[model samples]
Target chain A: MTGELAIKNLHVQIEGKEIIRGLDLYVKQGEIHAIMGPNGSGKSTLALTLMGHPKYQVTQGTISYKGQDLLALSPDERARAGLFLAFQYPFEVSGVPLSRFLLQAVKARAPETKAQSNGRPVRRPLGQFRKLLHEKMEILKVDKSFAGRYLNEGFSGGEKKRVEVLQMLVLQPEIAILDETDSGLDIDSVKIVAQGVNSLRGPEFGALVITHYQRILNYLKPDFVHVMVKGRLVKSGGSELAEELEERGYDWILQEVGAASTESAEEKGADPDERS
Target chain B: MSDHEEHLGERKSQGVAIAEKPQREGFERDYNKYDFRDPEQYAFKAEKGISRELVEKISAMKGEPRWMLEKRLEGLEIFLSKPTPTWGGDLSELNYDEMCYYIKPTGEESRSWDEVPDKIKETFDKLGIPEAERKFLAGAGAQYESEAVYHNLKEEWAKQGVIFMDSDSGLQQYPEVFQKYWGTVIPAADNKFAALNTAFWSGGSFVYIPEGVEVNIPLQAYFRINAENMGQFERTLIIADKGSKVHYLEGCTAPTYSSRSLHSGVIELIVNEGAQMRYTTIQNWSTNMYNLVTQRALVYQDASMEWVDANLGSHLTMKYPSVYLLGKGARGEILSVAYAGAGQHQDTGGKAIHAAPYTTSRITSKSISKDGGRASYRGLVKVVQGATGVKSNVMCDALLLDERSRSDTYPYIEVDEDSATIGHEATVGKVGEDQIFYLMSRGLSESEALSMIVLGFMEPFTRELPMEYAIEFNRLIQLEMSGSVG
Candidate 1:
């Protein structure tokens, strides 16, 4: 129960349209969970909702982190409570250097006791912070120039994903939600990102990786693999489940779970009569 | 000028004494560091009005030369004849007769901090001026109200024939040199505000660097306005002789008052052949002040001039620092940043004029508006005829924090030369919701996220400032960004 993120019967909506319907998940401190789903399965929605995005309206759910009500906290509060999210489509914030942003985030995440008497967060010494940053960048194989460049501005898709992981390593959150971070990465880049994540693997770090393909799981080696369809998990298993899905597509699992794969049917032109 | 007498009567009936009551509002809360006012104490305070008699008295009080007195009278005539410009922020509410034209805080200037009056010295101590001077400044000058209370140059620089003192002292000590270069770059007929400044100018830095002398450290001047309904007109003139190099910095602040105040200043610089000059200003007036200023420089052959200006506070500000390249291969650069919060309108930019062949210049402006504030960039780039091989670029970027805020760009480019190269770019953007959410997800508060974005937008300007100033400017931006989120 300690250092655990528990979501029970979670339902989320966007603009009065239901997205996630009755999704339940529990991630402990020392576990790595992978959610594999096709397009439009509410994978990214779950990630955003977990981070308390303004756009995602939670209709019914109870999210508890470390025995506290996470729903009552703000997005920044949730982050300071040891949660992180690597966005599926990271927004480019021009003008802010990556190192400067990381330093602010690290300061904001410090405990209240570390704050000064004026109730302002005390900044970490520049030399110490730079040392930590350089070490993390080296682990992610990021060039030195990346630290001084504007955050995510003009960065390639692969660079963006690596920086996301790079941020996670620096922040060292207890639970990180990676939302399709490997969607647009090459095989080599995927391995580098996985290595960056693996460097943080321990009894104190947990990750919920959302992906459509099994390519990244080959390197991440998650402890649990759950097949998500339509909004909720349908089948939960081990690494072999991922290999099975890679060998044969999600059609067999969709039929076994009795849920129609709307995306696949639409692609194959088999759902002409169905209205979206 | 005749109509001001009627308004002066109305201002008295409204009880002008209450203007010094120090009304604390939400806007003034964040500016507490600069909002603390000292008790009004002055050796001589001019009556609240401006006229021929008042201008003559100001010139006579300084015991200036006959030519300077005649110049002041002529400036007064021009100022009274010119109608208020309607193109910039509203100046209809500015009352000339309701403001004290001059207030002499101390009888004489002191070369050491200990000799300064205790009250004025305490004010500068609170502002951290003396400590800053001891740390890195080559020389420092402090002006309180309409007089320079303290001014001193390090003996090393002073021994090298480098002159750094108040403009009044410059005229009295080096009359020949001051007379030779005074009003040469920016004349009284340049604009209405310049004319007003020329008529009532009192305390500003006059710096002169001898030929072949390089003052590696910067000379700084601090200006403070204390009384209510006070108009401060400081005139600064800097001359860098051939093969000389120097950097000058100025900062201004005022205490919060109920009634409006006016600050109109003129700064002129002459960079001789192969000389280098950099002038920086950080103007942070109170929210109840109207800041209208004119600053220009004349660069000679193979000379360079750079202007780094940042405007953070004022109810309305209209300023455009310009550089005129008058000789071949002259270089000019201007970097400006403006931040406008609630009840503020900042109309600021830069101008570059190429008057000779093979001159190059660049102008970069960045502005941020939040909470119904409005910021506009009004700039000009002119290349005259026969000024061939001239290259110039202008860039303006504005960031609006909310839907209620506004930003505009008015870029005027006039190119008469056929062989000139000119480039202009402007962008207006809002702080994206996605960007805020992304930063917030990484453990930063909303205000912190917004301030980071703004500081980033101003990196080009901050990078040109000294390390201490960059830190102070960042702190000021952070203060402005705090409690900005609703």
Candidate 2:
């Protein structure tokens, strides 16, 4: 029941409305899992809940990361523990520079990497940080001038998503949840983003790519595919499952769930509107 | 003038009270060392309340001419007749009967730093005046309490026929030029505060730049308030003669106090034909002071004037520096920035009046409010009936750091001429949770993000300041932001 990022019977509510009802998901290390669902299926809720957004209340759930209770930690603490979320809609900060924000984030991730001076935090020695940032930026195909601009302010849709992937790459988190990152990108940008996400595939990094379409899955080739309907995972399979859903739609999955409930209901499976 | 140019160490050897004192050891620019407090120390202080008797006594104390005394009496009558302003911040807390109109800290005004008392010199030193003058040094003036403790112009400028001295000395030494333009720019009945300042004004700079002369370095003035309840009313007048140019910088700092103080100053500037003048003020008053200052300038044909005003600290400040473009091809610009934090209210803006054809003006106002503070921008632009081809633009941007903070904008534009072009844009925004989340996800706390945003909001104003002042302005904003957020 427990894995790298294990969620058991997770129930999340926002403003007295239950968004994620009894959803369970498990993503182990070094594996990429795809959560594909239609709109309002609570796909983004799972992403936000896992990262500990204050607005998302986990009424009944247990989320553990590396055998530690992840639900109790703050967002930043969770991030420091190697958890990242590539936001669906990244916010903009008009005044802060991108390079400065990254340097601080990098310092937060690995405080020991920064060289200290006489009893003070010596800002990570700009030359070294800039070199490392330039390397990561080049790997992601980001413009060098992006570091000088304000964070996410006046950035194009693709540019914003690219910057998110770039942040995940620079932070090098143990696990990353990309919530609908491919929703607002073109075909070429999706492949490029998938390529950027794929480059981080190794024995140490894990990712959960939350998307509405299986187009990005073609490039990512996720090890596992999940269909979340009405706040619960209805079915899950290999990458071929993504191709099948790409051909068909959620109506077939709802009919199958209806037949299964008519015969005998699964206690863990969420009934679409039975509770209401 | 030569007496003030002596070395400070030699001045110490002259058996002066300050000469015997030693320099502070290991001075590391500790800004929190505002620990010097004199509960009640004054050689001469006028009693509380302003009356005809008080005005006559002040004029007699200075031994002024009959005409000047009569002018002070007329100013006092006008001040008593006008009511307190009800449009801006609250004025009900002001108790004029308990406030001291004048408090002379030292026995006499001194042109030399060595002749200044140790208490006043130490105050200016803590505020970083001596080192500032040494670094810049076109000229420097220092005022403590109700008197100009020290005034000095560099020999290079003093020999170039540049007149820079205290206003009181200016009135006595150069009567012809000083009398011609004393009340010409801003009359006594301009406002209630201006009328009050005209009656009790003391210890401000008087600068007159000659024709075709350009002062490369800025002339600096420093003002400090030492005792409580000392209603500081300094009057500054600057005149740039025809075809001249000058830049003036003034900085003010006061010790924090539990009791309230009042600072009402009047500044009038005259820019003659083809002249240019820029006056920059960085007012860092203590939180217990109510700074109500009136500053204006009159621009002649082919002239330009600029007001760079930055207000960082005050309990309630109501200042609207104005410019009157009275000649063809005259231009004016006012860049005003203010910050209000923790029980403070900064009601400040700018005004431009076009009275001639082909005149142009611009007003850029920026304000930040935090921790229950309130900042408002009240501006006005007017064009006369025959003042054709006039163009004016007013822009105000206010940032609130917390939900409890408040901001307001009031802009008035009147164009009697059909050929006038006027534009205004106003915006108010709070520190949203989205902004905080964005920065925090990047590992910054809430206050650090707010500080950077505040600095960016005031970038236009900060960039106009000299490099040193701009850096200091950013630091001050950082300090205020730390206290207000996160």
DockQ of each: 0.78, 0.30
Q: Cα deviation in Å at residue B255, candidate 1?
A: 7.0
Give the per-residue lDDT digits (tens) of candidate 2, residues A169-237.
888888899988998798888988888898889878889998878899999999999988767888999
Query: In candidate 1, residue B219 scores what lDDT?
Result: 78
Q: For residues A1-276, could you state the per-residue lDDT of candidate 1 as single tens digits?
A: 449999999998877767788999999988899998666777778899999999888999899999999999989999999999997777888768899899889888986536666534455678998999999999889998999999999999889999999999999999999988998898888999999999999999999998877989999898999988867888998888999999998989989989876576433232111111
Error of 2 at B119 (Å): 20
Worst 10 residues of 1 chain B by lDDT: B15-24
For model 2, how does the per-residue alpha-carbon lDDT over B247-356 read when each residue is reduced to its tens digit?
99887333322233788888899999899999998886656678888888999999999999988776788888888999998999999988876667787888898999
Least well predicted 10-residue stretch by lDDT in candidate 2 chain A: A267-276
- Residue A50 Cα positional deviation in candidate 2, in Å, after optimal superposition: 2.7
lDDT of 1 by residue, B1-486 (tens): 112222322434353222111222424543443333334455777899888898888889889999999889888888989877656566777888898888776533313434333433343333344454421121112343323332334566778999887888889999999999998888888888888988988888889999989998787664222221123888899999998999998874322222237888889999999999999988877677889888999999999999999887777888888889999999999988898777777888888889999999999999998877778787778899999999999999999988877788767788999999999999998888777889999999989888888888888888888887887677667756884211
In candidate 1 chain A, where is summed lDDT lowest over 10 consecutive residues?
A267-276
